[model samples]
Target: MNVPSNRPWPRAAWLTLAGVVVLFFIYWSTVASTVAIWRRSETFAHGFLIFPISAWLIWQRRREIAALTPVPDWRGLILLAVLGLAWLAAEVARVLVIQQLALVAMVPALVFTLLGWRITWAMAFPLAFLLLAVPMGEFLIPPMMEFTADFTVAALRLTGIPVYREGTFFTIPSGNWSVVEGCSGLRYLIASFTLGTLYGYLTYRSLKKRLLFALASIVVPIIANGLRAYMIVMIAHLSDMRLALGVDHYIYGWVFFGVVMLLLFWIGSFWREDERVKPAPPVVEYGWGLPGGLKPMLAASLIIAGFWPAYAAYVEGLAPNNLAVRLQAPAGRNGWRLVAPVTDWRPEYKGMDASLHQTYGKDGRVVGVFLAYYRYQRQDAELINSQNVMVRQKHPVWSNVGEAAQVVELAGRPVTVIETRLRSPHQRLLVWHWNWLNGPFTVNPYWAKFYEARARLLGHWDDAAAIIVYTPYEERPENAARTLQDFLRDMLPALTAKLEQAAET
Candidate 1:
């Protein structure tokens, strides 16, 4: 039997294979389970399609993957370990699963490590294309919503419809129809872009063509979404909000989005070239018989390994004390009435000044609950006012009913008051009556260690902040409030001050 002499696998493949196995185990044991739970979350449930889509894409690219140059890379194994830990920590911290998709980190490490620097550089595009998995930049939502609303309003007006228009909203005298949150077209924009990207990649081999189609995928969705909103509003105006805003609204969107996507695919077909190409052989090299100077690399690997665990431990140790306390349920506090059972109420975490909550109803068929909390230790203040009202115009999935400010006294001290109301019917609302820190935050030693390690890598830290969200009957808002109060009470003043400073900046 003859083996390729140029192949470096005997030195590198076995190690990488072992590393891959270990990473897969870590994923299956921890990250995968957390991802499974995330699949049930509103922000990431769409990620359920990632695997199937990725599989299909890989299948399409099988010929390409097979043709890539193969080189041995023992060093990549270390990177593999590093990425695995990142994925695991992301899972533990309840980070957005899309943001943590292993392919973004792992695939690059695998490709670069084993294939040598030159080949990995050559194939950066396909490797980067894998990053479609990392759920990123719903940032497009605001702009997309703006465009959709503008287009819809204009289109409606052109059709001889009387409309009163403001920023992203308009009222038609035909009925009291305001293009609220759900109409913002964010869902369709995201869905269309995802599907469009897949279609572009599979069909267009040329980078230029792929990019053009990808841009079109993003643009067309917003246009189509606007049209969808216009149609629904027109229908409702002609008929009633019941038919448009009722059960049929989402069904209508799905139907229209499907049609628009079909059109996009049809238009995209014009750009594809099905030219034949010959199979290419993998380039291989094997000059280094033995790797040199292992001690420094080994030390570096060990040092890196300790990063996450240390951060996790620190966070655990710093875990804010839980100050469980019951706050009296308000029957009709500030026009927000309790329509559910009065059950358990306790502060869940100790970070902010205080938190308080109590349930107002039963489990399944309960009406609603009331929750309130104060954040003396404000974290991520920028995020508090980041809600894009214009985006809500087309995507009406998120609604800010209104907000009013009143000077409220807390601990007998006057503080700035902010209250915003958001209404989302389909989403299960949980009043996080406690620390609303964004991304990984927990005082568990393991979590703290993990966070610390990540900060060293990512080179940034997030401040602990508190936010109180209110929703219908989905969860016990009051209980959430209590949880918040306790957590805040336990968070020492020094830590609270640090968090506040972090947030202010």
Candidate 2:
């Protein structure tokens, strides 16, 4: 059963290695972007270890992989082509997450192309596991935060504590607590899932057990995070708002998460069926002869994989280098006159080509308008971006207490707008916002991105803007909503004209 230590490498191995290296170089930018996220984001820093772990996993099954003979599969080229085109579309749309996914997917496609189906199947888990490196699941945050807040509030009420909830923020007798991004339990969920999958792969041979364990991994952390938040609140409450209210809050969270993970793994290990290695079969000699048509297939594979990025570059090159946008305030009409901004609050939109903020008032009713314009958008500068928010999570001056999509009549047309409620200590305001991509207005971020991509692909100008209107309210939010609705009804035509004028300029 002793395998030779000095076995020479097979041609298939060489070809696979070379193809992977070439593919890495071909999509280095995407790879680098993934790595950059790992460097910057604590939640995704586990991405730094994913590739090395995948490689180690493959090495552990090297004997099984070595026993299989290589038969280069042309179907892999088809997969590569599809993935490349997907990457191209994401690139054009400035969607980094999709581009990273497509790029990571290419790794397996390349391996399948060079080493054939048998070896690819043998290493399927290792290859598939590489996808964990992607920095996805940020979309899950808002929901997770809401869930945590709900769970915490309900648990408090069950324990006879009076609670008043407003969106993700709640007030208790002890203190005020808000479930921000860090409290979302996303990091815990991701960590649990990653470690659980790996542990299941190593411990259990049955797919059913593996899947169940993975599912448990996902569920346990979310519930545990809720409990953790509740316990922290209780600690602060019991201590007269003195404990679990500072750095110790995060410290306790991590400690609790660690214990929960340990418990999950301990319970999972009870059904462990450890992998037992069998004796290696005799190696067949397929000499130094190059297989027929492999060279052409390899060449075609590289060509198909490489073409998308080049075409994407050409498409991007078609975009104008310098776009001069002149965004002017719309003229006041229907008794609303332009006036000074009463408050210093403004929406955060970074790297815009132009911006305008103005106030308009009529008969004691005042509304503020803010517009962020973009042309030739790129990373960190796109109209539809997570950073381009109405208010940050824990703003000193403003808190986004509630937000939802509402359809309202604008110039006698029903248009969807995102209505958000902003609260400060002194004032409460209702805001309506939507994106203007070229000509169409959409409250959905996905549609905005689609409009931008469509315009770019059609060789049309990808000019876009975020339009926000807000008004203060004292007693009821409905009054503020009515104020904004009235203002938009009076100014929709003029606002559209100004945006169109800027786009043309």
Candidate 3:
């Protein structure tokens, strides 16, 4: 690669660099958070390479970029402002994914604003590729896990092996297997998509071929993962659970994926169209100095980009000082009396300002109630968080086998709750949970975050709580569900009143 250092730096290049530096400093926290995730999560570790790859892509186009002249476009400021507001909204809601996306988006907006459309267009791919750095797609885990389980179980049955499945957990005669987060193939999908897109970009100049290859990259990994899972199970079954049950399980998966990827690339190679390099076009000669009115546009763009973080900080400062919070248990009524918790299962909720756990008994049935209350919610301490779940994947004492949204009557009105089923070696439970944001009940995390952001932005109390109700069952889960509904029918009004009183206090 020939370096171009003979000519002076273009004014647009200088301005764009300055804008990017400003953006980095203004959203340093978001940048740091993204890097932290990349470091910690094996699934998102690919993020570390995204920047360098994008830079390389840009470097490849340096000759073409040098041939064009840049003119600042004022319209970029409008995009900057929109993205800034979006970042602020994500900040207020404490949605890390959105915050990261908004921050990444501002880079292209800055380039566009400072370099105009033609120059921005010249570097569009590199700019757009930066978005792959964001650590997202966690929402796909459940569905992917479901598909893996379905495929593996169906394959086992077809092979004349009897299998029993419940949610992502399943049992074969040799041993038991559960498709936890590790088996969801999310890492595979992300890796394949990233590499495949990069491969398509490099190998095929045609848009149709590039898109088709990218689509194949996504589809192949998913199907390959399903096939990989089936083979792993087969190995375990054939070996009497001697192999592919522990460390080798992951090893086998990666080895299989490597083979599949190689096979895919080989197949795709037949249709590859290599770009023929041409001599660089002569660089356009223009005044090295900044254009008139460009300075004002740059200033305005920086102001628009910088305003969001400032407003976010101000809004954050408005959060009230943490106050001492105490929650009283709902009084038992209608023959249901408060008693010691019958089981040791508890929902995994952290950073709560207050928490209450109580068990109620009527006749032979026992029901448990748990509340994780929060006031002045903020990052790492909010009620709606991925960390707050029914059961951690690696928990030794429990496993979450199934969960879904369920609608049930509460205080004479139907309300949706997250219905979770947990299983242990000796116990089984059915749980119903929802977030109590101010006074409204919501099972959707997005809605809960929206309500929290609305309350905080409007200068109201950002009070929220995670409410969970559960009951133990031996065989019939429907019986346990009935027990919970009956208990809630009689106990919800008092529980609501107690929460209201706590909020008032």
Q: Highest lDDT among the candidates is held by which one? A: 2
The C-alpha lDDT values of all candidates are 0.50, 0.87, 0.86
How would you encode candidate 1's per-residue C-alpha lDDT over 1-505 as one tens digit per residue?
1122454434444454454454444344334554665465454466666656655654555565555545434566577677756654553343444225653567567645555555455555555655654555555654565676678778888998888764455678676555544566776766777777777777877878888888998788777888888898888877755577778888898899899889889988988877467566555443211143222333333344345445544554543354222333333322233454432322133333333343323232222322222222122211122231212333436544333343433333433333333345464333322233433333233343344335434434433344342334334444533432333233323233444444444
User: Which residue pairs come into collision in candidate 2?
Assistant: none
Off by over 4 Å in 1: 1-18, 27-30, 41-46, 52-69, 74-103, 117-129, 135-143, 165-169, 179-181, 240-242, 278-282, 286-310, 320-505
- Model 3 lDDT-worst window of ten: 1-10
- For model 1, state the Cα shift of residue 8 in Å: 8.2
The reply for model 3, stretches above 4 Å from the true place, is 1-9, 276-291
lDDT of 3 by residue, 12-112 (tens): 57767887888889899999999999999999999999989998998898878877666566778889999998888889989999999999999998887
User: What residue runs in model 2 are displaced by over 4 Å at the alpha carbon?
Assistant: 1-9, 276-291
Candidate 3 Cα deviation (angstroms), residue 281:
11
* RMSD of each candidate relative to the true structure: 11.1, 4.0, 4.0
For candidate 1, the per-residue lDDT at 234 reads 86
Q: Single out the weakest 10-residue window by summed lDDT for candidate 2.
A: 1-10
lDDT per residue for candidate 2 within 364-479, as digits (tens), equals 99999999999888888899899999999889989988888999988788999999988899888888999888777888878887877777777777899999999989889998
